[model samples]
Target chain A: MPILIKDRSMVTPREAIAEGDFSIGSNVYRREKKVVSQVIGLVTIKDNFVSVVPLKGKYLPRVGDLVIGKVTDVSLSTWIVDIASPYPGVMRTSTSLARRFDPIKDKTRKIFDVGEVIVAKVFSFDRTRDPMLTVRSDNRGGGNSPYLGKLVGGRVIDVSPSKIPRLIGRRGSMISTIKHYTNCKMIVGQNGRVWFKGNNFEDELLVLRAIQKIDREAHTTGLTDRIKNFLEEAKKNMPTPSKEKQSDKEKRSEKKS
Target chain B: MAKNKEETVLITKDGIRHDGRKREDLREISFDVGVLDRADGSCLIQWGRNKILAAVYGPRELHPKHMQMPGQAYIRCEYRMATFSVPDRKSPAPKRREKEISKLLGEALNPALFTYLYPRSVIDVFIEVLQADGGTRCAAITAASLALADAGIPMRDLVTGVAAGNLSDKIVLDLDDVEDKEGLGDLPIAYLPNLEKVVLLQSDGIFTPDQYKEALDMLVPACKKIYQLQRKAITDKYSQINEAVQKDIEAEEKDKPAKDKKKAEDSKAKDDKKAKKADDGKKSKASDKEEKKKKGLKKSSKKKDDKKQASKEKEAKKD
Candidate 1:
C-alpha cells in the first residue's frame, strides 16, 4: 500500500514518498510501491500529483528556447556559439543568414565574426549532438522576426535562467513595464541572458537593476507589482525629457512672438 | 618530543579519548550549503577543526569525446588540500595521496547518483580542504554529497562519512589529528545511511578481526548521525528561502488593501466637503455634529490600525 503524505513542505533525499504521484519533478524517482525524493527541496502537490520544486539548478537546454549566444568560432559554414550551457550552440550559415550565400565562395566570418552576440532560437537539440540554432523562423510568411539576428550596441546581463519567467512575468507584463518606464528595448533569453538597449547609459543601468532585483527575488509572489512600483519610483527621481522638450517649445514660441 | 610521548595516553580507563570524547562520540559537524554563487552547487563543511569546501559543476558536455559514456554520466572528483591547510606547508602539486582519495571519492559517490539521466555528460566534484585535523577524506566526502544535492543532482541516497580508529587498544569514533597520529588502526568509511550499505572503506595500520568488526559497528551509527546534520543544513537553507517568499506574498497582499483604503478615504473626504457647503445656513450646528462623528470614526480607525499592527507583529515573530 502506498502512503499518502499531504501538506509536507520539504523533503530530503531517500525519503519514501507516495506512488502514483504525478508532479514528481527532478531529483525524484519511483520504486516498487513508493516514490523517493532524490534531493532536498519543497514538495508541492497539485491536481493530486506530487513534484519537488528545486531551489537551485543548472540550466538544461530545450528545443524552441530563445537564447543569447556569443560567437566563439566562425568556420566555413557554421558558427560555434556559446549559449552559456555545457553544450555549445551551432548556427549554420544557411539557417542564420536572411540571404542565401555559397559557403565555397563567401567567407562565413564576414557574416558573423567571432565575439559577436546573436539572439537566436534553439531549432533542434539532442543529447548526442550539439544544439542547432536559427536566427529567424523557418516560416517564410512570418516575415522578419524583430528580435532575431545579431544584437548591436547593447549590454548583455545574465541571471539565473529559472528566474527568467519571473522577469518576463505573466503574458510579458513585467518586461513591458520595464520597457515603458525606461523607454528601453529589452530581449530576455531563456538561457538567462538579457539584452538591454536604451537611449542613454543611465536608462540601461536602470533596466539592469530591475532585472537583477527580479532575479534575486523571483521566488516571491507579487513580484510584478513590486517591479512596477520600483520602476515608477526610479522614473520619478530621473530628470524628465518631456520637461526639457516643453521648455524648448516655450522658448521657440517666445522668439517667434 | 618527550611531551608528545608522555601525552600519548589517548584513552583513559573509562574509554574517553584525548579530546575528552567518549568512545563512539563523533566530532562537532556543521554544513553551509550553496556557498558559491557561480557553481551549480557548493557547500562548506566544518568537521571539528577540519574545514572543507566542495563545489559541483555540470551534467554538462564532457570533453575528449573518447571519455564520454553512452549510457551513463561520468562523475569526476578532485580532492586538494591547501598548502596552509596542514601544520607544515604542503606542496601545491597533486600528490599520490590526493589522487588516490580523489579516485575513491568519485567511485564512492557514483553509486548514489542517477547518472543514467544525463548520458554523455560529466559532473565534476571539487573538494578543497582549507584546514586538516585528520579525517579530512571523510569530511570531504560528506561535504561533496551535500554540494551534489545542492546542485540539484538526482541521487538514490545521500552519502555520509565517518572514521573509527583503534586508540590505546580501544575502538574510538572520529579520531582527531592527535589520535590519528598516535592510534594503532584507522578505519575511514563512507556509507549510504538510509540504504545501510558501505560504498568506501579504507583501513590504515592493522586491526584484529574482532577489532575491525567493532570499528564497523561504531562507524555506521556515527555516519547516520552526521547524515541528520547534513539534512538539517540543506533544509534550513531552503526553509529560510521559503520564508522570504511567503513574506513577500504577505506584503503584496497587505499593499493592495492599504491602497484601496487610501482611495476610499480620498472620496469620503470629498463627499464631506460637498455636504458642509450645502448645509452652509446651519453651519454651527452641523459642524458640532460632524466633529463628534469624526472623533468616533477616528477612534474606530485607530482600533483597526492597532489590530493590523498586532497581526503583522505575530507574523514577524513566527518568521
Candidate 2:
C-alpha cells in the first residue's frame, strides 16, 4: 500500500491521492481498493506488484529498513556492497561475501571493478542491529548493485533511516544548502549509503566537518543558516565561479528564446 | 425539627459560619434541564456538593395499569447512585439504600402531583447521583421536578427543595454529609414557591416550634431562588423546540419536490399508457390482414441451417 517515489526519493503512502501523471510501483489493492504509489517512472510489472525504475539514484533512508548486498574482491570489482547496517559497507573489497557475481567476470575485478558498489536492501533480525541484506528488483539498477556514484567516505554516524526525509527537508532544500556551500559531491545511497567527495582533499575534510556538525545539531532550528556560515568559512580554500558569468548566460538564453 | 442534646453556634463574632457562609446566605444551587436527547425529559441539579441527573419518561400508553389506584395514574421514581458516586464505589445495581430512597422520594412528591388527569398512564422518574457530598435526596427532588416540567406534564407549580440543617448548631442552609451526620439537627423541605405550600417535609432530631418556624422561614427565600432556576431550565428546553420544529419544516420542504416529481411522472405515464394502448390495437388489426399475403411467399434461409445439422449427425454416425 506504500511506494517509494524515485524522483523525490520519498515514500508516498496509500492514503494520499496523486494529482496527475504519477507512476505506480505495483498493482496495489487492499480489500479491493487500489492505491496509487508514485507519480512517474518505468515500473517493473512482476506478478501483481511493481517497483519504479528511478531515472536518478535518490534513495532516502528510513529509521529501520532492511537491505541486502554482495562482497566484491578487495575494491577492484572487489568492494563488498552492504544492504543494511551502518558499518561494513561494500567491505572495501576486503571483507567476506554472502555471495559472488558470475564467474566469467573475474572474482576480483570483473563483477565489481575498482570503486564499484552495488545496491542492497536491509533485513534486520536482531533488536540491536540492521539486517545484514541482498538485492531487490533488477530494475532498481538491479537493486543496490553499485551503478554510478562516488564511494564517499567520512567519519560515518548512524541515523534512524526514518529521519532521512526530515533531514533532507522540503524539496532537498536542506541538503542542497549543504551542497551549495560545501561544493562536495554528495551521493546518498539507496540503502542508507551516503558518500561525500570534496573538490579537493581539504574540501573533503571540510565537508566531513559540516556533516559532523549536522549530525550533532540535527534537532535545532535555523540549521540552513548555521550550515551556510560553516560553508562560507570553509570556502576560503575553494570558492565558486563568478555570478557575472551565470547572469550573462541567463541573458543569452532569454535573447535566444 | 428537634435539636440534639448538645447544641453550638456555626458563626462567631467574626460574622462567618463554619463553612464560611454568611448568616443569611443560601447554599449554591445550579441546574440544567434536557441534557439527554434519548430520554423524554432530563435534568441535572447541583445543590452545593451533591449532584444528580434525573430522566423522565411517560404519559405514554401504559402496559399495565393494575398498579394504579382507582381514578388516578401511577408514578414511578427510582433514585440510584453510580458506583463511583461516593468516596468508595458501590455495587453495580441500585441496592437497599437506593430502594428506600426511591420509595421515600416517590411518596414525598406524590401529594403535589395531579396524576389523575390521565388514566392508564405511568410517569417514570429515574434519578442518578453522580457526586454525593450531601443532600442528594433533596437534589434528586429538584432535578425530578425540572425533568417533569421539561416533559411537558401539566403541573400545579414547580417544587423547589432546600435542606436547612444545623451545622455547629447555627441553622445552615443545605449541609454536606459530614455536617449532616455531625450536626445537632437537620430539616429537608421541598416547597412550591408559587403555591406557597410545603409539598415535602422531613425533620431529623428535635427542635423547638420556634426553631421549626425559623427553618421553614429560611426555606421561603431559598426555595424562591431555586424556582427561578427551574423556570429558566424549562424556558431553555422550549427554545430548543424551535430548532426541532425547524428541522421538520426543512424535511417537509424537501418532501414537496419529491412528491411533485412523482405526480408529474404519474401524469406523463398516463399519456404514454394511452398511446401504447392505441398502438397495440393498430398492430393487432394490421397482423390479421397481412397473414394471407405472407402465406403466399415461402422463406428458404432456415433450410441451410437445418441441412447442416442433419449432415453433421450423419458424419458422426459414420465415424
Candidate 3:
C-alpha cells in the first residue's frame, strides 16, 4: 500500500499514484491494485483516498452548480444557454421566469433575449441530455433571494474552469477578500465566467487583473495572501473618486454582500 | 538486390552504418512540449532530421452531431506533411497515404485514452510533419501522444513509436531516409510501454520469420527507451514551473514574517518529505545502476545468440 510519488507532486497520465485497495477519487483510475493518474495534475492522497486535480480541462455540468451562461438562441419555450461546457444548458420559459406570460401574444424574446448573460442553477444534468437551467430566485440556497437572475451592467470574463476553485479560494476567503478590497459586487460561476461590477471602472479593472493573475498562478500554493497583498497595493495607487459617490457605491456593495 | 547492397555500402566491414552508427543504435530524439500557446496542447519532436508538430484540441462540442459517439468521445486525428518538407515538394493536398495514416494514428491513440468520460464530444489531434525523414509516422504518433497528455486529456498510457528495419540482410534498430528507401524491410510500431501492448503495427517490404521476430525484439526495447525520453520531457516542463513557484514562495517568505508561524509548520513537514525523497532517490539510483548492469549482460548474451544464428544459417546455406 505504498504511495509511488510525493503527495501534491505533479503527475502525468498513466503515472502510478499508489497501490492497494485505495478508494479512488476523480482524475484517477484503478488498474488492479495500482491507482494511476488519468490526467496531468497534482496528485493528492488523503487517508485512503487518492485523487488528482487536473490543471486544465473543460467544465463538466454537475447538478446544483451555480453557472453563468450566455443565451445563445431563444426558442418558443426553451432558451439555449451556453454554460461554457460541452453540452448547452436549456433554460425553459416555464421554469425560468417568475410570471406566467403567454408566448403567442408576446414573443419569448421579450423576457430573455439572445446573448443575455444569466446566472442560473443547473437543476438537472446527465450525459444523455443537455443540462437544465433554472433562473427562478427560489432555486438559489437562501429562500426568495435574487441569487439567480439575468446579470446586468457587469463585465463577464472567462477563466479556466479548473482554476475557478482557486479564484474562489478555501471557504470563499479569496472572493470575499477581492470583494472587500475593491468594493466590487462579484458573481463567480462554476463554469468559469466571472461577473463583476465595481464603484468605478478602475476598481472593476483591478478585480479583472486579480482574477487573471489567479488563473495564471493557480498551480502555486499560498496564492490567497499574494492576491490580497496585490489588491491592497493596486488600490493604493488609484485616484479616489468623490466622497459622496464612493460612499453611496460602498453602501450598495455592502448591502449586496 | 544483393549486388545493389554490395555497391551502396550501407553497412561497412567494421559493422558501422553509413551515418557511423552501430546496428543497435537509435537516432537522436528530442521533444519540445507545449510550444503552441493557442492550442490546448502542442509538442514539437525532432527525431534525427525528422521534425513533427502535434497539437490537441477539445473534448469539447462535437460538430455535425451525427458523428458524435453516444458512449465515448470521438478521436479525430489528421496527419499532414508540409509541401516543402521533402526534397521534392510534396503535394499540400491530403493524399490516400496521409488519410490512412491519420486514421491509423487516431485508432492507435484511442486505446491510450479514457474517451468514455466525455460523451458527445471530440478530441482532435492534428499532427503536421514539418521536416521529412524516415519513420515520420512513428515520430508523429510519439509527438501526438505528448500533445494529448499536455492538453490534460485523460489517458491510460502514453504511446511510443519506433521503426526497426532490415538493412542489407542485417537488422537495424532505427532506419533513416536512405535506408528506408533501399532497405529490405521496415516495421513501424506504436507501443504502450507501461501496458506492454502494441497499439499500432505496420510492416512494409519483406521479412523472413527470424527477421520478423528479431525486429519485434528490437522495436519493443527502442520504443521503451523513447518512452522514457517522452516522460522526462513532460516532467521537465512541469518541474520548471515548480522551480518558479518555489522561488516566488521563498521571496514572499523573506518579505513577510508574520505569516512565518503558519508556514513554519508547513515547511517542517516539507523538509521531512524532502529528506525522505532524498533517501528514496538514492535507493532508486542504486537499484537503477544494478538494473543497467543486468541489461548490459542480457544484451551481450543476445549478441552471442545472434552470432550463433548467423553461423547456423551459413552452414544451412552451404548444405
Candidate 4:
C-alpha cells in the first residue's frame, strides 16, 4: 500500500508502533503475537500504552550502547539532555565539565550553550522515566563540556526513530549518496534528528531535499538515481545564473530516448 | 542492501551530478517483459539509478504437499537483495527486510490477482535487485507485479509501488538515496491504483495520524499514475510482439509467388480442370480486379480479400 500520508507530516515507524498497530513499513498490523523488545516497533494507542514487537536483531542499550547525544541543560548535581527518545535522560556532574569543580570557571562554557549538541554514549539506564546518561564512554569528560558544540548551518530533518537504518540505507548507502552529491557532512542522531553541514547553501539545500527524498522512499530501489533525478529537477526549477555548469544534458539525453 | 557513505546521491555545487545529472527529473527507465521465454513471466526493469530483473515461475506446482491447502492457492515470494546490489554488498540469503517485503507484497497482490482459482498450486515470485538505491524493496514489489502479469498469471488487480517521506517533518514524494538516510520519516509504500488499498508500508520518523493519512492519500493518485505507465508498458510489449509477429508472417509469406508457381505446376492441371468445370469463379475475380484498376487505384480489393482469405486458410490449416 502506498503510505497513509497525513497533511505534510512525516510519520515514523515508531509512531505507528505507538498506535497499537504493529508496523511492517508504514502499514499497521494489529497486535497479535507477543512481540517482545526485539520487536523494534509498536503501536501507541492512548499515548500511555504501546505494543512493540521488536525484531530479533534489535537490541536495547544495556549499560552502554556507544551512542552520541546532545546537552539540553546543566543543573547543579546533574545535566539533562535528549537521548533520541521520549524517555528523559540525565548525566551526573563530577564526571567532567567542571574539572576544577567550579561550574562558573568551567572553560567548556565557551563551546556549549543552552541548545548545543554533542556526541556521546549511553552510560547507563534504569528504564524508568529518566535513564542515567553519560558522554564519558571513553572516560574523557562525562558531562556536556568537550564534545558539546553547535551543529552549524545546514538544514535539519526528522525521521521516525525506527527508520534510522533505512535512512542510512544498509551500511550507509543513503547518507553516503547525499554526502557525495552535495559535498556535505551529515550527522544522523539515533533520536531520528539529522544535522547536515555543507560548504554552501545550494549544496546544503540540495542535501536537504535529497535526504527528504530518501526518507520518503527508503524502501525504493535505485534511490540514488531517483534522488539524483529529483535534485536535477529541483535544481532546474530553481532559477540560477550558472545554467551551463548545472545542466544534466547528458543524463537527460540518456533518459530521453 | 547497504548504502555507501562516501557516495553523493544528488546535487553537486554547480547543480551537476556528483557524476552529473540535471537538477530535476528521473533516471532513464528501461524495461522489457518476458525477457526469458522459458519463465512463465519475466521482466527486466532498469530505473536509471538501479538495475533489477524479476522472473515468475509458476502457478504450476505446490510442493511439500503439506504446505498446500485444499480450497485456495498459495503465493510464495522470495525477495533477495543481490550480494553486489549495494555498495558494501549484502549476503545472498533472505534477510529480515527481504522477508518482510515478500510477505507484504504477497498481501498487496492477493486482492488483485485471482489466486484462489488455482487451488493447491503455488505462484512463486522471485525478485533480484542487481543495484539498489533507496527504494529497493519498493522496486522489487513493483517489478514482481509486472513479472507476474508477464507470466500470464490471472489476477484481479495490478499493484504499483510508490513512497513518500518526511524530512525535517516535511513530506516529500519519492525519497532519494541521501534523503532517505538524512531525512525524517521515510514511508515506503505499495498499493493498487484501482482498489485504493495499501498493501505495504514502512516509515522512519514520527508522524501524526492525520499527517500519515494525508501522505497515504497523496500516494494513491501517484500509484495510479505509475500503474498507468506499467499498464502501458505491458500493453506496449504485447503490441510490439503482435506487430512483429504479423510482420514475420508477412515476410514468411513473401516467397508465395515462387511457391505458387510450383503449386500451380502440380495443381495447375487439376485447377485447369476445375476452372473449366466452374468458369464463373475466374470471371468474377478478374472483373473485381479490373474495376478497381480502372478507378486509378494502385491497390486492388481483390488482392486484399485474397490475402485475408489466404491467412485465414493458413490459420485453419495450422490449427
Candidate 5:
C-alpha cells in the first residue's frame, strides 16, 4: 500500500495520500480518493485543511506589505519601482505624497529621481494589473505615517522572502532584539529587502551579521534563541556606554557653539 | 542504416546487445538536485553518457501581458544542446529539432502542474544538454521535472522518460548515440508513472503493429523504473537538508545550556566582587576612626561568609 501522508507533513510529488483525509493545500490535488502532492515541501494540515510549505518560491505581492523599492522609471504622475519581485510596483503621485500637486505644475521628476530607494506600502494589487504602492501614511501613528518616505544613507540587503517571517519572529520579537542590541534602525520589506541604519559602522556590521545568520538558518528550529544568544554575546564586547555618551556630548557641544 | 549493420552487429543471436546488456536494460542513471543557487530549482542528470542540467524559475508574473492565462499559469520550456554535446560540434543556434522538442516537453509537463493555483504567472524550465549519447530529449524531460520539483513547483507526478528502439529486428531499450544513428526505428515516451498516463509519444521510422505494441509494453516498465530513481533523487536531497537542519538544532540546544550556565556564573562573580569592594571601602573609612574599626571588621567577616557560601555551591555542583 502506498503511504498516506497528512497535512503539515513533508511530502514529495506523486506521493499517494488519502483524499479528504488530508486538506487540499497548494501544489496538491485530489483525484478521486487519492491526494497527490505537487511540490517537495512540508505538509501543513490545519483544521482539516492541508497545504504544503514550499521550500523555494518567488515572492507574490500582497496589499499592506511594506517594501523597499528602487525607483526604476519616473513619469509625469507615476513612478515605477522595482520591489525585487517579478512584478514592478507603481506609485502614483497622489498616493505617494501627503500634499496634493498638479502633475502639470509640479515637476514629478524632481520629487523622486530614478535610482533612489524608498520604503513604501502596497496599497492595492490585482492579478490584472501591476501592484500599486503608497508612501502616504494611512493616518496611523509613527512608522506607519507618510513621513516614512525616502530612505537615506543606509545599505539595502536582500534575502529570500520566505525567510522574512522568521526574521520578524513571533510578534516582532526577533527584530526587536536585533534593534535593541545593535541600536540600528531596520526596515524589513516583505519583498526581501532590509534597510540597516546604525549609529556607527560597527553596529551596522553587527546587524548585517545577525541578518546573514538568520538567512542561513531560517529553515532550522530554535533560530530565535540562537540569534538572541548571538546578540547577547556580541553586546558584551561592544564599546562601553560611557564612551558613547562622551562622544554624544561632544557632538552636541560642537553644534551648540 | 543497412550499410552500418554489416559493419557491426547490434544484437547477438541470444539477444544481448553490443553494450553487453539485455534488450530491456536501461542506462545507468543518477540525479543531483539544487546544483544552482540562483535558480528557484535546479537538477543535474547523468544518464549513461548523456549529461543534462535543468533550471526552473518563476510561477511569478508572466511577461508580455497578452500571453497571461486568465485561469492558470503558463508553463514554458526551452531545450538546447551545447555545441560540444555531439561528436560533431552542434551549432550554437537553436535548431528546428530543438524547438520541436522544447514544445513537446512543455506540453508533457503541463499535465503534472497545478497551474490554476498561480494565475497570470509563468513557470519557466530551461534544459541544457551538456553531453548527448542518445535519448537527449528524454533525459532532458526527466531532469526538467526534477528541477521543477527542486524549485518547489507543484506537480501531480514527476515525468520520467525513456526511448525504445528497433535494432536487428528486436526492440531495445535506452538507445545510445550509436544505436540511435543506426537503428531502424525509435519510439520515445514520457509517462506519469503514478497517474498511469502517457503525456508524450513520438516515433521516427517504421514499426509493425505488433512491434509497436510490444514496445509500449517494454516502455511502460522502463519508465516506471526511471520514476523510482527520480523519486529517490528528490527524497535524498531533502533528507540531506533535513539532517543538516537537525544537526544545527541539536548543536544549538547543546550550546545553549553551557552559555546559560556561564552567564549565571559571571553574574554571581560580579555580585561577589561588588560586595568585596564595598567591604574594602568600609575598611578604609573605618581606619580614620578607631571606634568604627570593630563594625568594619564585622562587615568584612560577613563578606567572607558570602564568598564561602558561593564556593560551597560551586563544590556541590562539581561533585
Candidate 6:
C-alpha cells in the first residue's frame, strides 16, 4: 500500500491520502480501500495512522471537555447555555448546584441568572441530543475551584476553536509561557474561550494581543518561540501603570467590549 | 432552430466564431476563493463576461425544529440576479426561473457532499450574479461547488460545468450571449470530474441523436479542463498564505541580529517592507470590487452600463 500524499502537506477536499490497510483518522473517509481527505486541511501521518486537521470549522462538543458558556434562558429545571457550538448546552439545576435543588420551591434564576457566564464540564453529548453540562468539579465535588462554576471578574476573549491546540502548544508550554510572563491567572476552555485576570489591566491586554497573534499564525512553525519573544518585547516597552488607576482601568476595559 | 439565420453568422467558414474563437475554445475562467470576511466560505468566479459571487454558510443549526432532517443536512440554495446585471434591468423580485435553477443546483451539489456528518443542520449557499451574459446557471453551479469545498464541507468529488452549443450544424463549446440567443441548440451539464457522474443536464432547442452524442463527448473533456483550473485556484490561495507566513518568520529572525543604531534602523525599515508585502500577498483581489461598491451602488451600475455599451458597439461593427 502506497501513501499518496506527503505527510504534513496541505490537501483539498476529496484528495486521496493513501491506499490499502491504513488506519483512518478524523476528516478522512475510506473509499474503495483508499483513504481520502474530507476537508481542506493539513494532513498528518503518524505510524500508519493518518488524520487531517482542519484550518477552520465550528466547534463540535465532546464529552469531558471543559467549556465556558453563557446562560441564555433559565427555566425552572434547566438553564440553556450558548457554548459556541452548533448545538446549545443544557445545565440542569439538580446537578449544577452544591446543595440539593428544589425545582418547584426555588427559582432557577436565583441559582444562575440569564447572561451569566459559567465554566462547566460537558457531561454527556451525542449527535442526536444537546450536550449536558455540569458545574460540579469532578475531584473536590462542589464548584469551588478556579476551573469550575460561575466565572466572575475576568475578561473573556474568543479565538477559533480549531486553533485551541496551537494556542495551548506542546503539553501546555505555550499557555504556561503566556501565564508566567504576564502574571495572569488564565483558564482556557476547549470551546475557545479564554478567561484571565491579571494584577493590572495592561497585563490582560498584553495577553489578549498575544492570543490574537497566535490565532493568526497558528499554521506556521516556530510559533511558540515567536510568541514568547513577542511577550518579552511588550513587557519591556510597556509603561508602568500607577497603583491607584489599576482598579478603575479594570472597570473601563471590562466595559469596552 | 436558427430563427435569424439570414441576419447573423455565428461561425465563419474558417472555423472562427463571431468572437474570433476556435470551435473548441472556452471563454476565460478564473476563481477568487475566500474573498468575503464574514462568510464561512466564499468565491467570486469570472466566466467570460459573467461575474458571480457565491457565499456558503452553515452546517449549523436548522431552525423550526420540525424541518430538521433525520439522517442528513438539507442543502438550501438561492440564486439571484442583480437588477442591473443584464442589458435590460431585471426586476428586484424572485422569478420562476431563479427558483427552478436554485432547486436544481441544490440537488446538483448534494451527492458530492457528505451531508450525513452534520445531521439536522442546513448548509446554505447564496449565489449572486452581478453580471450575466449567458450560461449563468452553469457558471453558478461551477462556483457554488467551489464555495462548498472552500467552506470545508466534506465532498467525494468536485463538480464542473460548461455548455455545448450547435452552431450551423457544428457542435461548439462555451456559447456566449449572442450565440446562446441565436444558436440552434444549447446543452449544459454539470459533471463530477473524477467520479464521472453527470449531476445536472438541461437541453434546449433541437438535437439529432448523433449531434447529442457528439455534444456529450465534447462537454466532458471541456469540464475536465475547467476542473484543473478550479483546483489550481484553490491550491494557489493556500500557497500564498504559506509564503506570507514564511516571509514573516524570516523577517522576525533578521530583526534579532542587529544592535548598531544605523543597522537596527535599516533592519526595522526592511522588516516593515516585508510585513507590507506579506499583507499584500494574503489580501484578496475582491478589494477592488469592494471599493467600487463603496463608491455608490448607482455609480457602479452606470459604469457597468458604459462597458456593456462599448462591447455592444464592437459587436455591431463585426456584424
User: Which candidate wins on lDDT?
Assistant: 3
Off by over 4 Å in 4: A1-257, B1-28, B261-319
Name the lDDT of candidate 4.
0.59
> What overall lDDT goes with each candidate model?
0.84, 0.58, 0.88, 0.59, 0.84, 0.86
A220 Cα displacement, candidate 1 (Å): 2.8
Please give, for every candidate in the order listed, the TM-score of chain B alone compared with the true chain B.
0.82, 0.69, 0.78, 0.72, 0.81, 0.80
Summarize candidate 5's per-residue lDDT along B56-167 as a digit string, tens digits.
9987667798998987889989999999998899989999999999999999999988787678888999999999999999999999999988887778889999999999
> lDDT by residue for model 4 over B158-243, one digit each (tens)?
67776676645455566557667766677878886655677887887788887798777767777777777676677677556446
For residues A88-120, write the lDDT of model 1, one tens digit per residue: 899998777777879678998887799999899
**lDDT (10s digit) by residue, model 6, range A1-257:** 99999998998877899999999899999988889998888899998899998877767899999998899998879999988876788999877777788767888888779998889999998878889999877665665554688888889988878789999899899999999899998888899898888988999999999998898788888899999988986874564554236767888999996
Q: What are the candidates' individual DockQ scores? A: 0.31, 0.00, 0.27, 0.01, 0.34, 0.24
Q: List the residue pairs that clash in candidate 3.
A: none
Alpha-carbon runs more than 4 Å astray in model 3: A139-146, A239-257, B1-7, B253-319
True contacts kept of each: 0.66, 0.00, 0.69, 0.00, 0.68, 0.51
* lDDT tens readout by residue for model 3, B71-103: 999999999999989999998999999999999
Report lDDT (Cα) of residue A111, candidate 6.
75
Candidate 3 CAPRI grade: acceptable
Q: Which DockQ value does candidate 4 get?
A: 0.01
Q: Which stretches of candidate 6 lie over 4 Å from their true place?
A: A140-146, A199-201, A243-257, B1-6, B259-319
Query: Of the pair 2 and 6, which is ahead by lDDT?
Result: 6
Determine which window of 10 residues in candidate 1 chain A has minimal summed lDDT.
A235-244
**lDDT, candidate 4, residue A69?**
52
lDDT of 5 at A216: 71
Model 6 per-residue lDDT tens digits across residues B12-88: 98889999999999999999999998888899999999999999998777898888987888999999999999999
iRMS values in order, in angstroms?
Answer: 8.1, 37.3, 17.2, 24.7, 7.6, 11.0
What TM-score does the first chain of candidate 4 have?
A: 0.57
For the record, the alpha-carbon RMSD of candidate 4 to the native fold, in angstroms, is 33.3
Q: DockQ: which candidate is best? A: 5
TM-score each candidate: 0.81, 0.40, 0.83, 0.43, 0.82, 0.84
Task: Write model 4 residue lDDT over A61-153, tens digit each, in one string.
Answer: 345443345677766556676654434456665652324445566534454445666555565654332456654435355653334335655
Which CAPRI level is candidate 4?
incorrect
